[model samples]
Target: MSSTANTTYTTFTGWVDPPTDIRPPLTENFTCSVAVIGGGLAGMATALRLAERGVDTVLLESDFCGHGAGSRNAGQLASAPGGDIQLLNLLYRKGMPAIIRLTENAAGHVESMIEKLGIDCDYEAVGNVFAAVSRGQLGRTRRIAKILRRAGAHVEEGTARELGIPHGFLGGMREIKGGIMNPGKLLRGLRSAVLASTVRVFEQSKVVDIVRGNGGVTVETPGGVILAQKVVLATNAYAGEWDITPKRLSSPMWVTEVETEPISPQRLAALGWTSRSGLITQHNIMENYRLTARNTIVFGVRQIERAASYPLPERHPDPAVVADLAKAFARRFPPLADVAIDRTWGGWIGITSTWLPVAGTVGDDVYYSLACNGHGLAQATYVGTLIADRIATGITPDDLRTIWVDEPKFGHAVPMIMGRLGLRAAWTADRFNDMINGSKRHAREGFATAAGGFTAPA
Candidate 1:
């Protein structure tokens, strides 16, 4: 396929665009108490928090604020942790309580922000489901729920029907917190809040380099430079692009999502999706499905594309990958099989080898928080708030200290060639499992086999 066909697969996101109140880019030298680079959720939240405390802060974005992953995500306000909860419990066993606190607080913080700032982003606290597509996956979910609960998360285990989830999934765990929203609207609202603050905001001001001086840092942009006593690197996936940032801070991954044409309310009701809670499958690279305010279903992310190098270039969702997502959607919701996919878009997300969100300082003056995995919508905002508080008071909260690392020790590199092969293998395995234990068959089979033998459903 032509590069244009791939690049412009979906030019615009289906979400309603918020008002564009443009901010001018920096054209001359500027100075501030804290200079925040990148204007996504983390950066904006950090700047807003600092400015609220009367700190001289300047935020610079290559594009408009929230134009990156903040506005490009599935919009699920997840309270439970991302990645593998089981693995996290094993690796950070002692830090489980702190981790759980951070996850739960992240979700709560978003709701608080919405109420405080009066953001009308269609906020809902209906909670989210860790749905299973097969009998084996259902068993996995039960195990995961145990791990999460042990870590002090509020997780309820039940059958898909018992939990009010649609028919396509089997029994799984439901987090007591979290919901869905129009991320575009939420991000725009945050941008507005930040703009209202005393902080200086600039758009289209990409920082090309950073230099550490005697007592402060110098941020070099094309149009000008920013001299500040402290700097917050809220760039997330783009953090690796800067030489000053640790090379393995984040591995950039691209994920795609698609929205469907609005379905009839009656048809939506027929699917038994009454709760309207977002759903995520138990695959290695999970697929997410959620209900939109417009009566449409949005789903995507059966595959991910990893950037080969840093300073990531702008790209679009591949038409072939989007087609695969549509196919997955059809298999999961046969009733909506014929629904036309309205649009498809993708964005870069940061993923660390540890598969855990992290925050720390590179030095006395440079601070960073990144790799929230795919659950950044809430974590990013909360982490930013924590970082801002630490910068202002020089006192780190438990939450901030939990993820704070003095030096980044990255994992071994999974060669791109091997990574692609591993992804293919995983996709193939999921497909094979789907064929053997189809949703209908798994649902009919009732409860899966327990440690002893097949157990009856409750």
Candidate 2:
């Protein structure tokens, strides 16, 4: 259970090794119809769409494409929107239907893209579960499921036994739309398609400044400049580095993930994880667990780190955080309590001030879409395509309007309440509830303990 001793701390994702065909940096000036500033999933999708539509497009990145969260997420293509569902309904109740529709469509887009690109990422249509660790959390799941169903989302709620998830979880809700896949593999597939497309891609090309001029926008880089009719800022958390980006656009949060050593198939079967759907607990800051095709369990995100300043630096998972995650993993999967951790990594993601993804124009000819709030695996890709469609055809689709803000101005990032002390408070509250639930269960039945000197977090 001591994860740090045996785990390899990696600066990059453990899902797939870095690509070898990294395109060279931009060294000369160029002109294009649209220039995408960032080569993550959103930027790549935007440029790909533009190229397919015969629009001359260029994508610029600080590093190679998919070097960010595109390759580093938990790989759960969520059908439900990110953030607390109940709160979203309370505030933006009228817009819930459109939001749900957009999310389900986003997941579908990823599924279709996977098939169209022929990306072998071990994709499974087994939708993810909003699993509960305690009775209160279970009730919350039921309420959220009702909210989602009323909003036209396909959702089902059941007990752990009925849902076919690990017994440690109580009754929870499952979104029937989205599923899981190897995100790095999917990203690599997109990268390959982009490389083969007519769109110009400049890897290692960091955009330093953006200036609007007569009938054009100038994007300045260290080694080159790009003059474009329009510019799309798809940098996500890194958007704060640019002054042109609206103030308080989003707050950057650093989250960690770890993978365990492969477990025997028989042992995995013993856990009664028949559905094999990815599980995300209903805590304020949720923890995600999924069984990989390689027979290893990948999990993380019980705690998150905040960025102190812009232009985020590359970093590895904190040792303490990894050890904490290992403990949590043991409690959730007691059957695999002793499984050694293989590797750990972390990545940066943007959390919006409004807790909803946003897209709008900063000025004439300057468009932006960002902060999918951890649902970027599908939402970002879909939103990117929508932005491209709007730019290429000069018409805004209804799906794009659902998340579009009339003004780019944003208030304080209240979601940052999940930062530092807020995160610790939430964890403490979850543990306290677990203790209460465990005591009540022990009183009803007889006390039982797990093997390997570990007990489930009831």
Candidate 3:
């Protein structure tokens, strides 16, 4: 809460403003070879690929493309999969290697795409770190590093000094494959490419219903109906808007991101963040911090708010949550404690039951990809391209086959349980651990009144 009352709350992301050149909504009935629903990163990539292959494709979006998590994410292209690697390994032992390979390759795909598209998104090849704030988290990092390395991921474990991170952290493992970038610019670049290509794009086109009859699927928006041979539903968090989507396909979680007022170069350099790698704390609900090219630092997501119903409403970051995040910022980057929070924003992102990125077919002509989890930056784009290729040529690539599900059935309502009460419990546990760690640190430092005075990072 450290005097973050001046922070500007925004419904959209703080990365970039809403695009001025919004494409007109569909106004007439149309037929096409393929129709892509939801113009986020995945849909745009899918339609773009289809158009490049000479397929008559139409991309339908409620808002402008990249308006969702595509532009709102922290922009860390992770080499390893999202969620706990140890859990993933224990659950899907044999699938771990393929998943690891896919994630690393996904990051490479983004790097290559950035170069090929000539995007000036302030991309830095400095890989991201799975940082540890306490001794328990440091041990967790070591164990996770071992799991990742056994699965063939390129990672390094070391102390904060060796990793070039801030001294506030004990140590962490660095994923050497992926890096950080200006996701807003990257999305704009992709949007430009899609608009320039032959793919017909319609903005502000809210789809009302989707009906499959005879040989084609009829996608109905408010203004018109589109009859296409195939349909690709790439809507991330809004997938629940359609009844056709699988039960428990994913959960929509609202996470916030806040940026600090610009800091001087000397102040930033004093933190010894030489590697300039984005840092993600190893908590149950992770907190991510990254330095922007604008000389400001952006961090968020210590707590998550899950949506109650579908058609997720547009909203700003909760003030209480933003305050909590600011307190966390002060602890993690004490050098920037006095820095004012410039603005705060929140976006809806989908997390699968398994905490894995998934792509599959609902029927014969309907295809879907959802829940890139938190690794949507690289994973979504790559999976979208794979889906496009699969539809373009009648063959599925091995990489695509790795995550492709034969049956679209999913487990019970796990996300609902993880929503409010579960989140509160997890937060309480983290805080309790932090208190214990703080007491130990104070005892070592010979502080007599450590019990009530110490507040540690967890």
Best by lDDT: 2
Q: Model 3, range 298-379, lDDT digits (tens) per residue? A: 8889898888997799899899899999998887777778998999998998887677888998887999988888898999
What is the C-alpha local distance difference test score of each model? 0.83, 0.88, 0.88
Task: Give the alpha carbon lDDT tens digit for every residue of 90-120 in model 2.
Answer: 9889999999999999999999999998889
For model 1, how does the per-residue alpha-carbon lDDT over 217-322 read when each residue is reduced to its tens digit?
Answer: 9999999998999999999999887888876666788899888877999989988777788999998778999998888887888888888887787777888888
Candidate 2, which ten residues in sequence have the lowest lDDT sum? Answer: 448-457
Off by over 4 Å in 3: 413-417, 446-458
TM-score of 1: 0.93
lDDT of 2: 0.88
Tell me the number of clashing residue pairs for each predicted model.
Answer: 0, 0, 0
